[model samples]
Structures are given as structure tokens and as C-alpha cells.
Target: MLKLDHIVKDFGNHHGLRDVSVEFPANQTTVIVGPSGSGKTTLLRTIDFLEIPDSGRYQFDDLDYDLSKPLTKQEVLAARRKLGIVFQSYNLFPHLNVLANITEGPVQVLGKNKQEAEAEAHDLLKKVGLDDKADVYPDQLSGGQQQRIAIARMVAMAPEYMLFDEPTSALDPELEVEVLKVILELAKMKNSIVIVTHNMDFARGVADKIVFVEDGQIAYQGDPTTFFNEPNDRIKAFLAAGQFNVK
Candidate 1:
């Protein structure tokens, strides 16, 4: 469903991604694993059009985005509608209550009426197990609750592809599982998902494909089973350095 060809992004003298190429199938979960500065987040952001590449091409279904050309505002918005990106931070609006925050996108982007958006927001809240917190403000909820609400807000937009950048990194151990449950459930759905995560167990359990990125390039890409069980020396070294226990 998604393809990146020779994608390269440079931030001054540092390279964010170099000659990165990969294809993600429809309705499958792909987990990108790497240490810090490994370009995992950059890859996700590029796909979401949050970071435009200096060169190369990105394709989603029939749509083609040439990074060499300047991106039009309308094109960027159109591309974003099909994808939802959850940042490391919850990025929820502090001023808006849970319901209002969740419904804003639909009301503004989708042009749904306020009443209709609110109704949809309620259903999304229930889906993420946050129906009771709909009336609560973001500050009133726990970190996990806020993250789940963030997920619900994204789901409300009905994105065809979801990008998760270290979804559980900001949470405590106990809180992490709560957010992971929602993400795991989303993985089971028939939609494309790209998750950049350090949670080895979650990646092993939910990913159809595991991509190990290092130094701004794909070091290894394969089935999760093989990746966990029979990784190469480079991968083993990386896993060890990251203190990722594969069990």
C-alpha cells in the first residue's frame, strides 16, 4: 500500500535517511526498530508528509508524491487525510475538552456538522475505552487516558494508514500497556500501519514485518519470527546495545 524509493533526507550535514527503500503491504503492521538517530522517526514522518524528502519518490496506492518538486499546500493536506500520525507526545489541545479535541478534525476538515461530529466522537471514545472520560479535560486524565483519547481522535478521522512514533515511550510501564492494547487492536484491523517503537515485545507480538534501521538505512528487513530468532551480528549488536530482550 505504501512504497518509498531511494528516499533521502538531509538535515544540514547530518543525514536523516539515506537511500532508504521499502514497501509496506496493505492491512499489515510493520514495526521499525532502531536506536536513537537511526532515522526511524524520519522515515515515518516522511511517509506522513510531515518531513518532505530532499529527493526520491513516495507512493501510496495510485497517488505519487515526488519529493524533488515543491509540495503544494492542497497536495499535502490531501495526503495527510489518508494517514494519521501519533507523536511521542500526546499533542492534544489543552484548551479543548476531550470531546471537542476529538471532533475538531472532522468538523473542520471533513466538514461535518457539530452535532454529527460530537456523536462520532462519542463512538470513538467508546472504541478506545474512554467514553466515560469524554467530558473530562486532558489534564484531568492520566497519561494513558490522554494517549488513548489521542488515538480515538485519530481514529475519528478514519485514516487509511496510521503512523505511530514511539507511542509508548512517554508512558510509565503500567501506562504503556494500556496504550499498547489500543495500538494492538488497531494492528488487527485491515489497514496499513507503520510503528517506530523500542518495545521489542510489542513489536515481536504485533508486527508482520520487522525492519531494523541503523545509520539512516535499512540494515535488515524480514518476518518477525526470523528477525527475533535468527538475527545477524549487526542486529544482535544493536539489540544488545538497546537492551532489548527478545522473549
Candidate 2:
């Protein structure tokens, strides 16, 4: 299980997270939703240690961290190996072909032989429906295709937990669905996944638990059905203003 307690991140003038605490259960998909600049992304980043918090206690399986203190390089790396994150941008190496990009981590970090890595990369490419594009460069692929490749690359590492921060926010509606489909498949495949997104429909359909954030704090956290069907006044207003077609 992944857990956080009294997490706080101050950006000098404002707080990115205000004593926020939440638990993400193993093998469950947790979807985080909030308005723009509500610190939802900040919260997600903190989990991966990309944006270390000012103060808090974080527990990832048996590893524990004191957010107020700096973590050793080895500690950070050990924790990161168990988690994988995909961002809004595909962030693929433009210079490398898709297969090479996917194999790089496994070969360099995990010490897998090139032959083994390439074979696994080919299998992952097939899994993401990009088996034919392995020889192509990132620039040659469409935005949706590159994002799918990004997912494939992450899957190649076989992280115990997958983290997605607005993974499809930059793509068109149709393309966004393409990435969401892969995410749904990962969730069903029993990976512990945490996603920060604004897509209400996807969240409603995929989330086992919904966490609502506003003003750098959790406004609500519970079942998706209750979050949508029996929304409180604040959530009701947010849904109406955001124009989410929840029904």
C-alpha cells in the first residue's frame, strides 16, 4: 500500500499541498480530480518524489520516507523502481527508434541483455498495438501513437505501480480515448494505478476510488458512484461549472 500523512509543500508564497493525507490501496485504481492549479498534479508528483514535499511521512510498501529531510540517491532510486509515471508530453527520445527507446531503461538500468530487452520490447510493442512502429522514430508517429509508445515503454519496466499525470491532456478527443483505453487495460491487468485527470467520463468508468481536491486539500474521497450520483454542494457546483457529462 502507498500512504501519505500530513504532507505539505510550500512554494514560498503559497502551499502546494496543505497537510494532505491519503492512502492508495494496492491493486486499486485511484483517480484524482480537481480544478486547474488545485495542487492535484503537485500531489501526484510528490508520490514519485519528483516534487518532494516540505514535510510529511510517506510509506511505499516497506520503504518509509521523511519528506522534510532529503532522501539519499539510492533511496529515491529504489522507490522509483517500484513506480512508473507518464506525463502529458510523450517525452520520447526523438533521436531513437521506438524499440530502442523502450529497451533503453531495461538494458541500462535493469541490466537486461540487449537481446532479452529487444525481445521484451517487441512483445510490449504488440501489447500496445505498435508492433509495426518499433523501427520508426517518435517524430514520425502521431501524437496518439507516441503516447501509446510511451505507455508501452513504461510497461516494459514492469513497475508495481503506474502513475499518470494528465497523460492524454495534450491530445485530441479521439486521441485521448486511445491513451485512456490503454490505461483501462492496465487497470484491469491488476496494476496499482494513480491518475490525475479532468476527464470525468474516464474517471467515472475507471476509478475504484475518487479523490476530489480543491484549495490544496482533499474535498472528498470515496466511491465513484457516490462522488457523482450524490455529490455534495461543492462537487455539484464543480460538476455544473466544469460541464462534465457524468450521466
Could you tell me the TM-score of candidate 1? 0.95
Best by TM-score: 2
lDDT of 1 at 60: 84
Candidate 1 per-residue lDDT, tens place, 55-173, comes to 99888877898888988998888788799988888999999999999999999988999999999999878888889988789999999999999999888888888889998899999
Per-structure clash totals for the candidates: 0, 0
For model 1, the stretches where C-alpha displacement exceeds 4 angstroms are: 245-247
Worst 10 residues of 1 by lDDT: 238-247
What are the C-alpha RMSDs, in order, of all predicted structures?
1.5, 1.1
The local distance difference test score of model 1 is 0.89
Model 2 regions lying over 4 Å from their true place: none
TM-scores for all candidates? Answer: 0.95, 0.97
Task: Please provide, for model 2 over 1-247, each residue's C-alpha lDDT reduced to its tens digit, 9 standing for 90 to 100.
Answer: 9999999999998989998999998899999999999999999998898988889999999999897898889988888999999999999999999999999999999999999999999998888889999899999999999999999999889898899999999999999988899999999987899999989889988999999999999999889999999898889888878787544
lDDT of each: 0.89, 0.92
